[model samples]
Target chain A: MNSFQLLNGLTFAALLFVVASGFTLVFGLLRIVNLSHGALYLLGGYIGYSTATMTGSFGLGMLAAMLGVAAVGLVLDQGLLRFVRGQELRQVLLSLGVALVLNDVALVIWGGDSFTVPTPELLFGAVPVLDTFYPKYRLFVLGMGVLVFVLLWLLLNHTRLGALIRAGVDDPEMVEASGVNIRRVFVLTFLLGCALAGLGGVMGGAFLALYPSADAEILVFSLAVVVIGGRGSLVGAAIGAVMVGLLNTMGQVWFPELAYFVIFGPMAALLAFRPLGLLGRAV
Target chain B: MLQVEDIQAYYGEAHIVQGASLTVNAGEVVALLGRNGMGKTTLIRAIMGMAPPQLRSGRVRWQGQDLVGLKPHEIAARRIAIVPQGRRLFPSLTVVEHLTMVKSARATEGWTVERVFGLFPRLAERKGHRGNQLSGGERQMLAIGRALMLDPELILMDEPSEGLAPAMVQRVEEIVLDLKRTGLAILMVEQNLYSALTTADRIYVLETGRMVMETTGAAANADEAPLRRHLGI
Candidate 1:
């Protein structure tokens, strides 16, 4: 692939990583699918769009979106998933119901019209990366993605709280027996994951235009990224996103008819060979 | 340091521990002797606040505080640790990681990782091995080490020597005696009457979830009739 294409692919992969990382985190720790994660992302974008329109500041919009979706996530955790523990089918149905409700809610507020946040003037221009120019906003998204990845890595690996999280992931009963409140950990993890999704939604809206149906399409891609990356590993999610992103962009470029198969084909093969995605521990 | 006063525990509607009363003084090793199905493990579970064994009535007071409504972690945070039946080690974690994960929030001069390793050198040798990789003896040692990491005031050991070799059982006995010397209270539930009598300061014979007999160490060793009758030894 050309350098321009490569940079574009990397930028796309970075966005995917941002969204899928949270999906995987919630799935890994809580064993919750959180099908409404896409709705949360879409809600974040709408909140950001409205806030930015009102205040004329993208940064403030992002902050508002983060806080708004974090509250939504906490509500989902406490009101919904906490009561429906271990019932995967029920969670799926309920989350799908949440997605429908959120879509209707967005339609009532933002309507069916497409919308976009004007890229900040500071990040409006393109920067020459290799042989061609790359969007500065895309570069910012990539940079932010890496920064969050690093921060999350440090948080999950270096801190005492991180040790408890890891312990919970490995065996939650043992974690509870170890004198850490596993419920608090669950709530905190859910909020953190949702906040990431919300941030991704806002940034992604800028990258790709936002519409009501955007949640459904993005949810599919996010699920694909998570499955390909393995369920619980953050590093796996990032790597899987890059691999899928490259295949996605390149498949459309190189093989249009075979594009859809590219993502699932490799995943199926990987599962057949390793079962656990690359960098994922066996459950 | 621990008092279980006529505590009635149940699994669903089936009463498991029917008004079982027992006590373990500070620095004492008390054995709750019973057969496999006689609610020994159930009573321990009720005391630990684990589910399935619902505390129907009576009280489990530790240093005069009621333990009925507390969660398992809250109970553990109060300095009560359990080397549970089946040595419930996290199978993915190494012995060292298992111990390190549960390191006490409140530091105590009595027990440290170093001291635990010193007590069970076999555990130190197998520190890097995952829970599933270790033999039964090694797993039991790791379980004890994991509990000791909490620096617990009272440890409930359920079948510590359940599936160990004779030598490993002897080593475990030594560890228990050493722990008693350091003034930590222990409540052990064991079917091995001889081993229980050898280490325990006092013994409570449980028959069908009720305490049938209580005796001192000397009396327990001297008399095997109760054990022979109840446990069919």
Candidate 2:
């Protein structure tokens, strides 16, 4: 309700958009419920933290996070998921195995104590927004969200790769039969999606801090956002993120006891009217 | 050139394509004709490496390279494209997007998006429309256009005239012949005898997953009785 709360909501939404888009796109194209996504997010933040600590550059850390997670995604897709093909159940279980393994690996590498990724010196301070001051890092996240939106728009609408992604989402075999190496497309999309999660994780870590339980929390938030947004739509993910982000922050502010109730209440109503979610096409 | 020699495929325990074999030379238009449930589509799927009936034994050779074990995209990369039965189009993609999404097998002198639009002006007019939004005829045209985008040397069209109006059937016939004129080889599966008679250089009949008959276009055209005996139409 208040400006401060509204700003917090928007900032939260921006990060959510970055994370949930990857989740939905991977699911849409491959029908793989990549449980490893949250682990990847956590991995990104931890790697980003270590990379920045070593390099003394937030940019390099971000880059390393994205590339590192992308590498992991490619390995998962090419080495294991490709062999499974069309068994959604097998894929889900495989991904769960990956998630648990990665979670353990992360725990071994980084301790259970929480750590916050430092905002770049350029975005270290606060900026005035309406009456109260807002963190510059939040504004930076908002800017990154806008950039991601535009980039995704151009990629999906104007690029051949985008067309392939959309087509693959509809019928992957048909795309392959069109003489396209849809295998490469699938792998690349998976990597790109994971990279997005990495970016979001680093950004989110700046605000939310990196801790043992953060991955589970983000995974839950991302799942809720994708379910509300509907799968197979970039615009839907963005809108869903904003709705969930606002509801989460507002619920805590107004009705602390029933925050879960506040979030699910609207989601349930929306699903009752449109079972396919906001923008999801039928499977 | 393509050759399917002694290929046997199965759907679990149910034998589908039993010793099916056929060949297509360059600039040839071959029609695969059979009654419904004769495994005409299963043969096509086998050739394309899509397994419903897994290829248990076969040598699918294209230009001396065995394609039995190659993936769908690899087969496609060898300049083979399938306009699959029911048009299997991506319902979400726009007409223009369909033509742009493919990776052309031919680097140069290939079918471009503009060329496809010129071939089917109706598709050009509705370039912005999604695949599901287009009419039956338009959907068929878009499917063909999508295949053309790959610039394949050989195109496999499965029941291209299926579910089409009489007028649309005529259009598809003309389009098939027009594509043939470009010196591209075509293997078309058609129930429409007229379209087959019109476009095919040779016709092969499949009876329950086996190649039952093969006849030249000229001989088949001259004597309808022999072809009619196979088709029963």
DockQ of each: 0.49, 0.71
**Cα lDDT tens digits for candidate 1, A1-283:** 7877787778788888888999998888888888898999999999988888888898988888888999999888788787788788888888899889988999999999999976678998898887888889989988988988899888876566666676677778767877778889888988988998888888888888799889987787788888878887888889888988888878777888998787778878888877767766665
| After superposition, candidate 2 runs with Cα above 4 Å error | B103-108
Give the TM-score of chain A in candidate 1: 0.96
Instruction: Give the Cα error of residue B82 in candidate 1, in Å.
Output: 1.3
Residue B175, model 2: lDDT of 89
Tens digits of per-residue lDDT for model 2, B19-113? 98999999899999999988888889888988676888989999999998888989988888999999987877788778777743233467887
Clash counts for all predictions: 0, 0
Each candidate's lDDT (Cα)? 0.85, 0.88
Worst 10 residues of 1 chain A by lDDT: A157-166
Please tell me the TM-score of chain A for candidate 2: 0.97
Per-residue error at A160 for model 1, in Å? Answer: 1.1
Name the docking class for model 1.
acceptable
